[model samples]
Target: MQNKTRYFIILLILVPVCFSADILLGSTHIPFSIFVDMLRGIEIDETWRIIITELRLPRAIVAVFVGIALPISGLLMQTFFRNPLADPYVLGISTGASLGVALFSLGGGLGMVAIISNFGFASSWGLIIAACLGALMVMLLVVTIAPKVYDTTSLLIIGIMLGSVTSAVVSVLQFFSNPNELHAFLMWTFGSFSGLGWTEIIIMACFIVPLLIISFTMQKPLNALLLGENYAQGLGVRISLLRFQIIIVASLLAGVVTAFTGPIGFIGIAVPHIARMVFKTTNHKTLIAASILIGCNLLLLCDMISQLPGFQSSLPINTVTAMFGAPIVIFVILKGRKSRLHYS
Candidate 1:
């Protein structure tokens, strides 16, 4: 308890520092004094004002929410399937979003994709709507089938298969696409926290905040689930309802993040383990809180790194995250294997 409290306090301190770093250390440097003056509502150089207010500020906000949304979605999946490997991507939600984007971007101006892609603000809305619909379609399919499946492993396999199918469809779209459209679609897959304005951020918050609140409320049932479905049911928990809720919440969180930011990979799979190792407990209350802070800080750090401080060129957000996150995931898998081998 003391350790958790201490870590929580440290996280509170680091979050603001990281957030400030995100805004301050970008392609164009904004000096501390100038930034402070700008924040205080004083007029500043036009270029600096636009960069700080329009670009960096919105990007940092999106990073915070993306960080929060993905890890929580991951924690829910890990709990839901009782599998450490389970993540937002594992269930094909992001792949579904990718398919939606592909169809919209490279569907050759067909039907709704053509109409929606033609509008300015509506183009973004079209992508969001298409991604959500694709994700919900998969979620509904999984929900219907999950009840009949006796093993979580089988369900995990089903999700992988679905993702594989979606990927193939995307590949076909890319193959047929012209180079210009293909380049655009490729960049979206690389993931970014930039280019999101206030409107998109608000739309994301509407989905993520309510789902996060509901997830926090499910702590008891989630804790119950850790012991197995039979045990959970024995304790009078409604396993079916709880499973349904978890799916909906996880889907919405993952879906929305993917819609806006593209599919951010390893953070969803890696950050929960970081939380577990740091807090040294499976308790959802602590895990969820720690995951939120750690995830946010880590992504902010990634965003800062992606800016490539010494160079004018910026790296893709997904590239930076995967570089850090993939190693953590590999370490966890190897550690788990060694432990199982020792016990066996």
Candidate 2:
């Protein structure tokens, strides 16, 4: 318990430091003193204030939220499926979102850009709505199939199949799309923490914050679920209803973030496992808190690395995350296999 408390305190301190570093590590570095002044609302150089408030601020805020949303959604999916490999990306939720964006941005032709220019509201909301619908469709499909599958392995296969199908469809769309639209879609696929403004941030908060609060209320049931469905039912938990709510919340969290920020990979699959490994507990309560803190810090660190000093152009957010997260995933698979072999 003393060790856990110490780790939590360390993580809490790391969050703000990471956040400030993310904001400060761009092309034009903002001095730490000026950053503090901007926070205090004391007037400084106008250029510095604009950089701090208008540009770096929103990116940092979105990075924090994406960090939080993906890990929690991953945790819920991992628990719900009882599969370490399950995540928004693995389960095809992110691809579903990418499909939505492709259909809206690629299939619709150059006229869609005109729509975005003419109607400022449709610029972001169109993609959000499209992505939500696509994600919901995939979630509904998965839920419909869940009862029929007897094992987690079969379900994981189905998820990979779903992702492949979506990718094929997106490839077709890309082939038919014009250069401008194709370029736009390609860049979005790279993923970004920038481009979202305060309004989009508020929209994301409206969906994510409430759902997260509701997830906390289910920790007791989630803990019971760790024992198995029959055991959870014996403990008076409503299995079907609980399953539905978890699916909806996880789907929406992944969909909304993907809609706004493109489909970020690996963070979802990697972070929850990191939380469990660090705390050495299966308890949802501790895992949830640990995932939030660790998720935020890890993603902020990724964001900073993506925009390293002296680089005029930043690396894609996905590139950096994959570099870190893919190795964690590989280690997990090997460890799981070794454990199974030992038990056998």
Candidate 3:
């Protein structure tokens, strides 16, 4: 409890600092004094004001929410599956979004883009809508199949197979795609927070905030689930209803973020482990909160790094996250193995 309290305090301080750094330390350097002045309602240079308000601020806000949504979704997956390796993408949600983008980008002259554009989302919004539909399709399939399978391991394997099939389809699309279209799709895969504007951020928040509230309300049931479904049911938890809610929440959290930001890997898998290692508890009440903070801080840090000081161009957010996240996952796997051997 004391450790959890300390972690919370540390996160309270660090998250804001990270967010401020994200706003101030982008490719275009804005001095702290200038930012402070802007905050105080003083007129600033037009370029700097636009840069701060239009670009960096929205990017940082997206980073914060993406961080919160992905990690919490991952934590729920890991707990629900009772597998250390389960993540938001483990069930092919990201692949579904990718497929949607692929269809839009590579389906040249297919009139899909034209059809979507006719509805007034010809820009990034169209891509986002397509991605959401793809993700929803996969989630619906998983939810439909989940009831038939008594064990989570089977469901886990099914998700992997679905992802593999989706990837194959995407590969086929890529092979036939025009170079310019392929490039566009590839760039989207790189993942970015900067592309989101205030309107997009508001839409993302509408999905994320309500889902987060729903997730928080399931804390007791989630904790019960960590022990196994049988054990959770023994505690009077309704396993089927709980499972349904978790899948829905996790799917929306991951699917919406992927739709907006492209597919961000590793954060979902790694951030939860980081929180667990720090707080040393499986209690969803604590883990969920800790994951939210740790996830936000980590992504903000990644966003700062990707900005590449002194350069006008930024690195892909996915690249920065994977570089950090992959090693952490390896460490977790090895540690888990070692602990299992020791116990045996």
Question: Top lDDT: which candidate number?
Answer: 3
Better model by lDDT: candidate 2 vs candidate 3: 3
- Please estimate how well model 1 matches the true structure, expressed as its whole-model Cα lDDT: 0.86
Q: Estimated TM-score per prediction?
A: 0.94, 0.92, 0.95
Error of 3 at 233 (Å): 0.7
Model 3, residue pairs in steric clash: none
- Model 1 misplaced stretches (Cα beyond 4 Å): 109-112, 115-123, 341-344
**Per-residue lDDT of candidate 3, residues 154-265 (tens digit):** 9999999999998898898888877877777888899988767888988999999999999999999998887789999999999999999999999999999999888999
State candidate 2's TM-score: 0.92
Q: Give lDDT tens digits, candidate 1, residues 1-344.
A: 59889999999899999999999998788899988898798899999988987899999999999889999999999988887889988889999989888888777634335543544322367777777777777777777888889888888899899999999999988888778777878888898888888898888899888988999999998999988989999999998899889988998899989988888999988999999989889899889989999999999999999996676878989999999888988888798887842111
Worst ten-residue run, lDDT, model 2? 113-122
Residues 1-344, model 2: lDDT tens digits? 58889899999999999999999889888899988887887889999877877878898888889988999999988887788888877678889988888888787663443333234322467766777777777877877876688665677788789988988988988887888777877878898988777898899899889988988998999999887778999999998888877877888888889888888999998999899888888899998889989999998999999889888888999999999899998988898897842111
After superposition, the stretches of candidate 2 with alpha carbons farther than 4 Å from their true spots are: 109-123, 147-155, 341-344
